[model samples]
Target: MTETKTIQKTFWQKYSTLMISLVVLVIYGWALTGLTFSGIQESAGEVSSSIFHGLTHPDWAYVYDGSGEDLVSLILQTLAIAFLGTVISAVLSVPFAFWAARGKNEGKLHPRSTTGKFMLVLIRTFPEIVLAIMFIKAVGPGSFAGVLAVSIHSIGMLGKLFSEALENMDHGADEAIYAAGGTATDVLTLATIPTIMPEFLSYTLYRFEIAVRSASILGMVGAGGIGTPLLFAIQTRSWDRVGIILLGIIIMVTAIDWLSGMLRKKLV
Candidate 1:
């Protein structure tokens, strides 16, 4: 009887807090949202109907027409922007990542200098679309503006990723190089870079894939890419042409995903 009582007490002790917490959360949510069983049913019905209609087949005739050129050009331009942006960002991120990693430097300076940290924060805080718009205004519409926009945003993103990778690196190699009286540059070349190379390449390629998609959209703001064609098609109410553009985008993005997946598999 004593053992049975102890077990019962333990079970309640472990679960009582969780049970109470769940009850409180549910009550709070319902009170705040004013949600009822009827509301849930209504929402479910509306969502189901909307989703059903949205999935209907697109116009097929556009695929055979020559209107696909705009989409094809937009896609190519977007790819070009993404590719250039990623390359520029990768190049710039390397030095920043090297400086940001701890134990890689024995100086009085912080692992990430105040300016560097602030710049990274600033770059990350702004949306890439906003940057693209701003650049479009400054540089006028074209692939170059899109590339600059993506590059700036990518630098912030990749810098952080590269820094984390560097931090996780083994200290032994860097320490050994320093002990051998190697300079910072020498140590970075001989030890830090080689160790982090695979991760760096993998991240860069992954960013490239994302940039390609983003570039297409950036064209909506007059930044050059397939987005321009898409916008034109939509404005003209040319659903047939829109269909072609959508199909091309789908194919291109899928190809990029597949290629990147294969590359990542080899890298990792």
Candidate 2:
């Protein structure tokens, strides 16, 4: 009986608050939404009937019908923009990351000093969508605008990643190189870069995947890609075309995922 009471107490202690909170939240949600179990039942019935009447199979033949050429071109353009943007970002971030990781010194101006930190913070504060909009206005609409937008945003992101990687690196090799009369450049090339190379590559690949999706959406703002077609489909209420476009996006992302996974596996 003592053991039974202990078990009961433990069970209540674990679940009593959860059970009470669930009941309270349900009551409050129902009050807010003006919905009860009966109302949900009625709504579910109506939705079921509507779905049965409206649902239709896709026209798979339409996928192969002449749209393939246009789709392929748009996809290639998106890839090119993503690739170029990622390359530019990676290249620029390297020096920025190195500088940003350098801590404050008494006599020297450090890269991670107040001014540098503030600048990085400011750059990172703006959303990528906002940057994309600004670039669209500044450069006019095209893939170039999209590429620039991605590149700008990537600088902030890659800089942060690189700085973190630098901070976490084993400094023994760098110290040893310095002790052996190596210059700062030699120490960075021989010690720091080798240690952080894997991390840099991984981050770049991940950003490339993100850039691909961003480039596609930039087309919505007249930046050129599959998003233009997607927008058209939406405006015309072409569900079939929308479905096909979504499938294409899924395929492209999956390919990138598979390729990146393989590369990361080899890299790590």
Which predicted model would earn the best TM-score?
1
Report lDDT (Cα) of residue 205, candidate 2: 92
Q: Tens digits of per-residue lDDT for model 1 on 1-268?
A: 9999999999999999999999999999889897545545647777556434433445554444455454555577678999999999999988776555554454436745545656677888877789988988898878888999999999888987887787777878888999999998988789978988999999999999999889879888888888887888778755556666777788999999999989999997
Model 2 earns a TM-score of 0.74
TM-score against truth, every candidate? 0.75, 0.74
Residue 264 Cα positional deviation in candidate 1, in Å, after optimal superposition: 1.7
Instruction: Give the per-residue lDDT digits (tens) of candidate 2, residues 1-268.
Output: 9999999999999999999999999999888897545545647777555434333433344455565446666788888888998999999988878767754232235534445545667777886667777888998888888888888888888888887787677888888998999999998789988989999999899888888888878888777777888888778756566666777777898899789888988876
What is the lDDT, from 0 to 100, of the residue 204 in candidate 1?
95
Q: Which ten residues in a row have the lowest lDDT in candidate 1?
A: 50-59
* Candidate 1 clashing pairs, residues 3+ apart or interchain: 74-226
Per-model clash counts, in order, read: 1, 0
Per-residue lDDT, model 2, residue 187, is: 85
